[model samples]
Target: MEESTADLIRAQLRRLRSAAGLNQEEFGKLVHYSASMVSAVETGTRPYDRPLLARADEVLASGGLLVSLLRIAEREGQPSWFLPWLDAERLARQLRVFQPTLIPALLQTEGYARAVIRCDDLLSDEEVERRVAARLDRQAILAQPDPPQLIAVVDEAVLHRRDERFRALMVHQVEHLIACAERPNVSIHVIPLSVGLHIGLSGPFSLARGADGGWVAIMENQLTASPTDGEADLATLSARWETVRNEALSRQQSVELLKEVVKSWP
Candidate 1:
């Protein structure tokens, strides 16, 4: 049978325990783990957290090997759906984004990012830090020698929401957007409230022109997201992009609107 990851780790643990010349109870005492906990980990019933793995590494004299193995398991731990979208974003020649409720992740400042990312209850603080670091890492591409053009259109009402929890955060985010808009390759636009219902009211999405000349679209639904490169989906998204862009104020006006919102923050 193919060795499952858990099975492989179980074997490693069992071998390491034997090599250390320690019985289950003795080894558990050394690592400050319960005897049953040790048995379960050896049998692959429980997952290893970093602290336990580190302790095992120290006690087994594995020279950080155990911790290194754990790192491999935790690396690239972004949500599965977001990975493909990130791949496309990294190499896109240009990206056009429509945001209905929050700042685009690429342009968000650290404080703003914290406010936005903290909405999730499923994440521990360490996991939240990992995600935030991952997000900031993605922004590095924007500073490369030949960065992609980023065009963003935000709903005017998104900035106007009186969200007390994120009130100050919104002010900082708006200022960041204005500064980013000044970049030679970036364009910012605002979809006026006067436009009344439109295609953008449906949701937010991004259209990317890849460096290889292919096109892709990324759509963000509540908690999940998806990316599509199929011709038909691209066509539909392209048409939607056009409709939304038409409803947005000119780029110059958008910057002014962004600056205008700063006065409303209390």
Candidate 2:
């Protein structure tokens, strides 16, 4: 939520409390928040988080209005350009990904996803939560009755990068990767650091195969994804996919590599 949205919620809280003939201290008692914390939220010094908002909604007799507002605010926080790609991902019969920078979105744990999102120091906490929710929501496709076949070719560097803040989640993510690889429909590969140069070094890309057997390539730059369905472009990306496939470690080898990382993390 933006500061403006926070202000709106605070205003509503204040009005509802006033109407109920309760002072800040009385309202705080009802909502189980400190008087100072209530004041901070109302005066825009603090944002209204979900749990607080839920309690406030119940105390103020708002009939879930605040909770509904939270949902609306979260949806509004999503980046505009990313929605289309999400639609494609949900519909794809098969997904082929070449990721070099970080774990693929489908395999990330909530903690790992938030740690990655927080790297953008500019984003507010509410914004960070929204992005995390969006990313986790995207992971649901993997659990569908006939989920997409996930083939991820990731570089070894992704496993080597470690910091105390994210190391635990990285361990969790690596274990999760190994688990996903065990599924018959999923295939994961690691491009060994020894393979100094590879086609994936250029950047990350994904190929989504549709039910009709048509393939589309999605590539991202700094800002947003550009999905190409043109025959020539798809053909070129297909060849790149084959080249990376040959350079990456086999599925069994990738599982072994992930197990190694799991053992190495402190």
Candidate 3:
């Protein structure tokens, strides 16, 4: 959670404790918290420390429910707003990412990501660096010994043209894609321009296999992101994705396409 949101949760905890008619010292004792620690949480000086949050959940008769919800916010390096989604994604067994306009973030090389970041009109160099760090941190998941299976579908256009420096970076990205595709856990698909209109016209979305083997669909538009965990909605998105997959070029064809584009680079 963002520091501010964490503060707010702490405030709520204080209120909840008060509502149960427990003084700071008494509540701290019940939750294994020091009186000063409780005071710190109440005043927003500290976030919901894990142990305290768990014990407090029980003391407040919440049956440990809030503990699970709050732990998602505790994951380090997650953006305050994106924490919940990150929590959901982190638990996924497989990831299906479709990028209609650009390269998939997880598969991007640092050079490619930096090149993409340079196109942002709003970010200062420092801000871009911060975002880059966060993105790279996310990419670290791909390096795990038993990382989730990743199926990335991208438009062939991303392989062909871009600014000159980005062209070099794109070459590296293509090479990386080829390497990753060779791995048992990764699959790369290319949607050709010849395929024409399809469900992807609605734009990019990520399909994740949840902890319970359910599907979670996540879409980010111009300014907002939405995640639909409903099975019905996910089923519809899965159908759409299947169409796009069928329309896309085969893996061998995509590799050949990348080779052709790399040969044409200036």
On TM-score, the candidate that comes out on top is: 3
Assess candidate 3 and give its TM-score to the true structure.
Answer: 0.71
lDDT computed for candidate 2? 0.80
Clash pairs for candidate 2: none
Span of ten consecutive residues with least summed lDDT in model 3: 76-85
What digit string (tens of lDDT, one per residue) describes model 1 on residues 1-266?
11243355557778888998998999999999878868856764344455677788899998887667544544546544554466567667899988878777888888877766777988799888877877787788788899999988888888786778777877888898899888898998888899888888889899877654667788889878878766888898899889988899998999899888998676
State the lDDT of candidate 3 residue by residue for 1-266, as single tens digits: 44454555666677778889999999988877788767755664333445567788889886665565565555544443355455445556788888888888888888878878878888899878877776777776677877888888888877776677566677788888888888888889998888777788788888877544656677878766777766787888898789888878888888787777777777
Q: Sorted on TM-score, highest at the top, how do the candidates line up? A: 3, 1, 2
Candidate 1 Cα RMSD after full superposition onto the native fold (Å)? 13.9
lDDT of 3 at 25: 95
Error of 3 at 232 (Å): 3.2
Could you tell me which 10 consecutive residues in candidate 1 have the lowest summed lDDT?
Answer: 1-10
Model 3: runs farther than 4 Å from truth? 1-81
User: How would you encode candidate 2's per-residue C-alpha lDDT over 147-230 as one tens digit per residue?
Assistant: 889999999999887778777778888999999999888999999999998778889999887664656677888777776666
Candidate 1 has an lDDT of 0.77
Better lDDT candidate (1, 2): 2
